[model samples]
Target: MRALRYLALAGLLATAGIAVAAPATYQLDPTHTMVLFSWNHFGFSNPSADLNNVQGTLVYDEKDPSKSSVDVTLPLSGLDTFVPKLDEHLKSADFLDATKYPNITFKSTKVSAAGKGKLKVTGDLTVHGVTKPVTLDVTVNKVGDHPMLKVPAVGFDATATLKRSDFGVGAYVPNVSDEIKVRITTEGHAEKK
Candidate 1:
């Protein structure tokens, strides 16, 4: 009957619509994620720093940048200035205050295409128990099924700068660094249901 045929056609159309409208989700792999930074020391030399406790999720719209978003967290206790003593000092109240705020987090409120494969990720950077607005310059490095996990994932390179003093980290002013540089290379792996 024509009624049955119409029902079948409607079902097919609904399935196609769902496929076309579904949003893409990419998960971040903590092992593959890296965050780095460097700051000037007394306006004479620059010292490098890296943090290794990055973990989070990234839901990206491959076909539409407007639908993309990111959530990331970097543990402050993992601060590495390449020196144990300096690292301990960094965790102190004068710096990160890891005891009070163990994590530095980024939760994107908006994402816009920066043209090419780059995107502008605007979010809150919470550090040392203080929160501030920060923007990251990001580039999608890769997107595909992860080889080891067999899950949909996205990789990105992100960079941002912050005024350390603004976060209440004003211990060594005029001698240490004023601006803090943060660089991130991350992979988001989709979570399994």
Candidate 2:
């Protein structure tokens, strides 16, 4: 009886030690992550801007994609329209009001595999002091070790269309266009620990 108990205890310990690993968490590589936005300008053209200095964490599960989650934050200070004056104007109270509300954030509530290498991510997006539900069509680019860093990494491209008026940034409305298209290309490095 004593020997049997010892064997059972050892087996339990071994099973516990080899338990399935949870989702891997990765730190967003700010230098490799960019957010681009475009909107119609008075029916004349579709002006575009890029947001830099994005920071976030992505928890990915290969076997079970539904277990994945993502949280990202983009600093309004990183707004860049190439034109300095336009960049400043975008950060002003008339637009994003970067001085008061400095960050735009998104936190995933649900993640589901849409098709091969594609995902439907539904989340809450907070911008300019307002929070609204948003969904992104995400496509996985690659997932493996980085050649330079020699560390685990993942890359994806995602897009979403939102109305600026929904976030209360409707400065020009129908003229400047209420609809905005956002694109994101991001790379994440696996977090050690």
Candidate 3:
């Protein structure tokens, strides 16, 4: 009976000693990320758009998947529509108004597991001083060691739809595509704790 009790205690200790995997927290490397947008000018014609100088961080737990989230912030002054005159127009009060509102940010409040590396991210997106609830359908591309940086990296693709008009970008809406389709592919590096 004494031997059996000792064995049971040893087994319990072994079970309790099981190690948990480490969580990953990565800082968005803007040079490795792309922020692209496409919209229709008329009914079916496509017009392209892009933004730069995006800065943020993404935190995720691969072992414990529930502990994952993202926070992305982009400068309004970084708005680049390609066309020289159009870029100025976008920064005016009728649109993003770069002078008044310096940054547009998306902060994730919850991350839900959608199965098989897919996640549903719900967050508060603040743009042009208007805050709104936004949901991003996200896919975790991979989490591994990056050969170049010699650091652990996390890759993911995210998509979200925004109504420009709702954010006070109502000018020329019918002419300038009311629905904006955004795609973000980010590769971020995790720092050593």
Best by lDDT: 2
In model 2, residue pairs whose N, Cα or C atoms come closer than 3 Å (at least 3 residues apart or on different chains), thus clashing, are none
Off by over 4 Å in 2: 1-19
lDDT of 1 by residue, 5-64 (tens): 999999999888565644567656667777888888888888887888777777788788
lDDT of 1 at 145: 81
Q: What TM-score does prediction 2 earn?
A: 0.91
Q: If the candidates were sorted by their TM-score against the true structure, best first, what order would they fall in?
A: 2, 3, 1
Per-residue accuracy of model 3 over 72-115 as CA lDDT, tens digit each: 89986677778879788778898888899989898989888888
Displacement of residue 159 (Cα, Å) in model 1 is 1.0
The local lDDT score (0 to 100) that residue 160 gets in candidate 3 is 90
Candidate 1's error at 130, in angstroms?
A: 1.4
Error of 2 at 80 (Å): 0.5
**Top candidate by TM-score:** 2
The collision pairs in model 1 are 27-188, 27-189, 27-190, 28-187, 28-188, 28-189, 29-187
TM-score of each: 0.87, 0.91, 0.87
**Which model is ahead, 2 or 3, in terms of lDDT?**
2
